[model samples]
Target: KIPEPAVAVDAVSITPCGEGFPQCDFEDSAHPFCDWVQTSKDGGHWVLGHKNVSIHGMGPS
Candidate 1:
């Protein structure tokens, strides 16, 4: 069984990207944006790459 969170989560605070906010281009940087975090609980995770992805038809064009 899943354990309940210790504190209430406020989902309404989330927002879309706006001016002055740094976009998630997944470029040069080694990590995700400050507001984001990396997790592999599902046995899969994000990989940072350049130009194109290794798996065909999977990532950016």
Candidate 2:
């Protein structure tokens, strides 16, 4: 059986991105944006972080 509360999960974005997503430098630097996936928390979920966005979860849906 599954435990009452499982371990904590977290996913960090790849390069060209900040902890909360940085600017793309559209007309200055290379690599506009970044993209990644998180599977440790809920079975391979897409993650796209914004400048000032927060994601909250309540266990299972």
Candidate 3:
């Protein structure tokens, strides 16, 4: 006889951001989140990018 799975599969539900937590879409502004700030200490910063990044075969298609 086959053994039953340890955990049962059930319906999944996702809670939208800002309801009880925070989220960022990185679409509207340079800053990703409300309290996020860019720093130059590492000589790199976060910037919004399109669906495809500059280099080919690197980013999402």
Which is superior by TM-score, 1 or 3?
Answer: 3
Question: On a 0 to 1 TM-score scale, where does candidate 1 land against the true structure?
Answer: 0.22
- Model 2 residue 33 CA deviation in Å: 7.8
- Please, what is the whole-model Cα lDDT of each candidate in the order they appear? 0.44, 0.45, 0.44
- Candidate 1, lDDT over the whole model: 0.44
Clashes of 1: 0
Winner on lDDT between 2 and 3 is 2
Clash count list over all predictions: 0, 0, 0
The better-scoring model by TM-score among 1 and 2 is 2
Count clashing pairs, candidate 3.
0
lDDT of 3 by residue, 2-61 (tens): 988798769998866442223556675754453333347834454333333222222222
lDDT of 2: 0.45
Residue-level error in angstroms, candidate 2, position 30: 10
Q: Candidate 3: global Cα-lDDT? A: 0.44
Work out the TM-score per prediction: 0.22, 0.25, 0.24
